[model samples]
Target: MAARALKLKPPPARLWISEWPRGAINAARLAGARRRLREVPRGDGRPVLVLPGLFNSDRSNFALRGYLNRLGYRAFPWVLGRNLGARTIGVEGERLFARIAAVAAETGAPVTLIGVSLGGIMARLAAHRRPDLVREVITVSSPFAGDPRATNVWRAFEWLTGERIDDPRVAALREEIARPLPVPATAIWSASDGLVNGRACRIGGERAIEVVSSHVGVQLNPDVLVVIAKVLNGQNADHD
Candidate 1:
């Protein structure tokens, strides 16, 4: 059978307008952290490593890491400073590989990788290159299944990474990054996302899940958090 072609259209302009309100609501999530904590299942203290999106640093995932910690998981930040795309993935992804190995060694078990947006793409790549160190992979709002230009942030990504969207190297890397992960993987996407086309985020298969959230708010969206908790606790038998 022939491979399916990717449809690459940017999301409607109106969707972008919802971002502001959604972000504001997500910011308010901190106020209910204690309450939200009771709603999700706890983990077995397995290590979880979180990666931030482009232009973001470990600080961007503070809330997420904190939440995971409260759930009895040993969550850690990437500690790689701001995400700058190709630079961090260079040397055949040695930097990321080393980090995963370190985390696995520290936990005495493979680590679960939870990435947000661009970070999700990196997580998938890490899992592909070193499945032995990865327990599972979960991506939020990552457009790994479609053309790189299928998102509103493509230009910003180019600006931050210093790589042209059409550059051969960038294209090749995207193709490699889009390959199916060797470890179990889940793609959590939001239909109301403004930065990227939601359709482009689907990984195609039983592992794809859809929620209602904004691109910037997905990290804090209550529904998204619940899903993450479920996946981490190995309670999502439907997807697995």
Candidate 2:
């Protein structure tokens, strides 16, 4: 019989108190954007699709997409309005898949997918379903490898998605989602994440980079951006 997946305890409530300060730090990243922009390797104008987390929309990833655009990559948003977990994934996932396919077709090159939090999970599923359309994937603070309920936001996910965490359908889908992607994938996690359990954010046999930031701040954190640039440029030998 297959072994049961281990479930980690959610992060402490006290740690969540640090989330506000982390948001401020991420906001301040804009001040040094130009400096950091020059520090990272420029992209080859390859197509990149950015997906937002749960309860977020394309607008949430505007800053990150803007940064990618400035770095010479053709970054595009998911275009599908706000993410509503299973509601989005169940009904609109085909649309998301079609979007990636369209971008890959237009560019005549496999698209790189960058997903934040729940968005990352969607990215992985997209890659798994259509690896031919994907070049590489980078997940920001996403707990795709472990139990979905391992994060503090699990309750919210259930409430918003209207799917119970332990429901048979959710359980079966979660099992599938936890599988490794067929393409080159990187998981960028934080040690100080306030919403998700960092320990649950790992996939076996893939590159995992640790950054110091909050769950929400990973998108704007300078170090995280640097790591992303390196991964995209194929400059990070460790990930290769």
Models 1 onward score TM values of: 0.92, 0.93
lDDT of 1 at 227: 78
Clashing pairs in 2: none
What is candidate 1's local distance difference test score?
A: 0.82
What is the per-residue lDDT of model 2 for residues 1-240, given as tens digits with 9 covering 90 to 100?
222456687788877888878878887975677685568777899999999998999988887898889889999988778899767755536888988988988888999999999899889888878899999999999888777667888889988878787988767656666777789999998768989888777767788988888886678777777788888998762321
Candidate 1, position 164, lDDT = 88
Per residue, candidate 1 scores C-alpha lDDT tens digits across 154-176 of 98998888878687876666777
lDDT per model vs. reference = 0.82, 0.82
Q: For residue 216, give model 2's deviation from the true position in Å.
A: 1.9
Candidate 1 stretches with Cα past 4 Å from truth are 1-5, 237-240
How many residue pairs clash in all the candidates, one count each? Answer: 0, 0
